[model samples]
Target: MAALGQHAVSKVKNAESQLVQEWIAALEASGGTRNVKGDELKADTREFLQLITSSLENGAGTAIGAAQWEDTRQFLERLSRNRAQMGQDSSQTANFIFALKGPFFALLQKEFASEPQLLAEQLLQASELFDALGLHTIRTYQASREAVIRRQQEELLELSTPVVKLWDGVLALPMIGTLDSQRTQVVMESLLQRIVDTGSEIAIIDITGVPTVDTLVAQHLLKTVTAIRLMGADCIISGVRPQIAQTIVHLGLDLQGVVTKANLADALALAMRRLGVTFTKAQ
Candidate 1:
């Protein structure tokens, strides 16, 4: 596709300030600047206009993927990510680029009022360029939002599996959800880290809040128990409800060497005894 004509580029460059003002106005009218700060939006508008003029001047084509438009691509990516972090949706982010079409098309019309063919050609080029940029912004916004979701999931897993120091030499992990491989990994890392940090000799894995136990859940528990043993701390499997015990038996799961307890209190009592942590009522 043809690059934006030099005349159109000059018009945009010369009327840059006016273009930004009109673009910002268009964006606000379209509700694109709903949660964005006025000052920040104005700064971004001015910087983006400058980048567009510079890109076209440097022979950058409508194909934004070209090396000539690398700066523009990076700029848009940053803008998209910022908008995503600000809780803005993809449409709002894309509008930040698409809203510029108004002021830009107006400039083109005035610049080529006498040349019909040139006006059509330049308008098509500018339209394609803006469309490409809008698409890029949307794609970047989606990627940024996905990244935020993944990070939050990891943080929640850590939050869900809390390793508490029950006694001087005992750590308790109170699990409260379906036992998945990912949660298992988080549990093992957290429990093992606490063992090392507190030098605890006994670690209790409590499943009182776990809804159900299947073969897969049993395997996840086995892996965590093995990891705790490798760190030289004994593991206690607690919260063995009647239904879970039946499930374990039906599944033919083995728990030969692992100690089992009926509840967290039993597990803590056993742990305290093993740790020789004595408690007496005040007289």
Candidate 2:
């Protein structure tokens, strides 16, 4: 019985020796190898695994040293858990286990025999986590587009303004606050619709209460005028502030044919003259 046990141990150790040598050779062939320290660590890990396997085969009490074995076991458990938890934000990536290749394990043993695999696991997890984050971002952006469209619709609804028809053939829309392209479009549509409804050939766009103007507003103005002209109507933009005029000039905005007046009254008078309609003073 004793002889048989001794022979079994020798066979196992001899086979393990060749495996250890082959592993070292393969590790050397692969670049990114540690020099002398890595060799020493590999030797230690090989010895530890061999002892554990031999003990299992021999019915010995235990092959691994109490402290070292416990520590290594715990280290592997933590490494696996941490690697799986990488990209923890992704609901789909939970509870994943790393299917480490044999070469990968050998590399780990060589480089990280002394310490736990914390750094390696963390690095791996971080890579996956970024992927998970990218997926989440894509999903968020997809959802946000619909939200933005809905918000745009709500904004269009809120852009409803008050149009005051001051006369039979003249109408005034006092645009208060700022005007963006969308709001300007809404305003233009409302004015055009009202013009058609009331047969008002002259519309006064009073901008006295408008906070400021930019190129976008100027462009919207151009579009509004074009639409009104298409409808056989004319628009007189009134209350051009000095600053707004300067900005338009500086931006090289050409309002060559678009009529502009000094104030709302002037715009109304211009509108009435073009329409050949006059309001007489009571005698």
Best by lDDT: 1
Q: Estimate each model's TM-score.
A: 0.93, 0.44
For residue 118, what is the lDDT in candidate 2?
A: 48
Candidate 2 lDDT over 91-177, as tens digits, reads 222111111124334543444456665435533532353343334333443444456568877775555566779888788888887
**47-104: candidate 1 lDDT, tens digit per residue:** 9999999999998999999998898999999999999998998899999999999989
RMSD each, Å: 1.7, 18.8
lDDT of prediction 1: 0.91
lDDT of each: 0.91, 0.59
Which whole-number lDDT from 0 to 100 does residue 245 have in model 1? Answer: 96
> With candidate 2 superimposed using the best TM-score fit, by how many Å does residue 57's alpha carbon deviate from the native?
52
Worst 10 residues of 2 by lDDT: 92-101
